[model samples]
Target: MKQAPFIAVEGPIGAGKTTLASMLAEELNLPIIKEIVDENPFLAKFYENMDDWSFQLEMFFLCNRYKQLEDTVTQYIDKGNPVISDYHIYKNLIFGERTLNGTKREKYRQIYHVLTDDLPKPNIILYIKANLDTLLTRIEKRGRPFEEGMDTAYLEQLIKDYDDAMASLAIQEPSTVIITIDGNAVDFVENPEHFTEIVSYIKELMK
Candidate 1:
């Protein structure tokens, strides 16, 4: 049976997930769901002192994201409305594992599973993979104050973790379709042809 499209654009920070998600949503006329980032009061301080605020920051995101999916995305998709989202909810765990220490990480994991278990899973994930330097440059250009102090080492690890998570998700959920995009390959933003090509590719896959 042809499945209803529930698309999620996923990758580490600065990988252009939101940009691509917007592009796809516009092309398909789908409702878009973006994560609540700037609204997180702890986000600014969390970046500055990760060790001190990891749990609080994570819990805040978890609650907010849960609300978004529950209130908006799920409601639309249940009525057969296609949905596109910038961030996959699972990234919370990928990040929580890296930032939260032993006990904290374990506790967060329990909470994450409890919350995400019944959440709607994305049937299509656009995994935008970019090189470290490319991501760093994009992050700088975006100029978010909280991201100014982002650690290169942390970003590097996130890149690796995201890739690993995608692979595992593919195996565990065979029904989910993952479309991996090479960020270094094309400037989809600056180049219309490249953007069109990406959209075309996604259309073909969705068919």
Candidate 2:
């Protein structure tokens, strides 16, 4: 049998990465690897005050994602099981660069490179793109306590960063396929047809 492909769904916050990843995993019969956002102890504090907790929050995410990816390779990839993840490991760097500054940022990069240097890359990345109004609306609908009253300016920058990161990934990793989807075009969570359309897209990509 052919080895199963690893698929990662990525996007700015509230862009539906987790929901899409879950749907794809079920449709494809693949294991899902989700980011442990609620488990981050520093997240609430970081959101309340970014400058004070930026490094700690980013480091926590980096360590957790590293371990998750390591286990993913051992438990799924090595066994030829297709895997779908809500967030790609590189998201740590994307968020880290936005939060950390100067010497701290440089130091974090060194550690990040060392930790991720040998990890297997996802065969395909699905990037969900949305306008700021759509993102804010979705974020409001979700109603996560920590995410309540999130800074609009911060979210604007995050969207830009995600776009830049995806563009960079396209140029840097020519072997990996990256597909950008307009988040506003489909309500995959509420509408079955929308979900089916996305599933069909993934099936075609896998072929």
Candidate 3:
């Protein structure tokens, strides 16, 4: 039997990672591993005061993501079932580095590396890119209370950080393919043609 592909969708906050992941999963008939964002007790508090709660929030995400990936590998990947994930484990570092600082950041990095060293990496990554204005508008439309007061400067910095992180991943994981999708150009949520285009691209890639 052919090995199943593990695809991950990544982007900064409000970049539609979840939306695109859902679309791909449905179109391709793949099982999805979604992020448990609202379930994190520290998320709302961390967004309110990042300085005080960053470490806690990162740790919470790290543990949960680790568990999810481990379970996914055993239950899905090992069975040769195609898997789609909303966020990749590497995202923990992307957000952690931005949230934590100095000694705290280093400590978190140590823990993250140790925990993730043996986990399976995604075969392909679909990185969604959108302008800040588009992202803010989507965030507003989503109507998440914790995200309503998100700092503009922070979001701008996050976009830069995400770019840097993706670049670094390209270099570090040379074998893994990264596909960039223009979120601003295509409204996958509204336009069927745009969604079909993306699905077609992914099908070609997988083939």
| Shift in Å, residue 10, candidate 1 | 0.6
Model 1: lDDT equals 0.88
1-207, model 3: which lDDT tens digit per residue?
545789999999999999999989988998899999988999889988999999999999999999999999899988887799999899999999999999999999999999999878898999988789989999999999889889999999999998998899999888788988888897889999988888988898788
Q: What is the C-alpha RMSD of each candidate to the true structure, in Å?
A: 1.4, 1.5, 1.4
Which residue pairs does candidate 3 place in steric collision? none
Off by over 4 Å in 2: 1-3
Q: What TM-scores do the predictions have?
A: 0.95, 0.96, 0.96
Local distance difference test, each candidate: 0.88, 0.91, 0.91
What lDDT is reached at residue 74 by model 3? 98
lDDT per residue as tens, model 1, 106-130: 9999999898887678898989999
Model 2 residue pairs with clashes:
none
Report the alpha-carbon TM-score of model 3 versus the true structure: 0.96
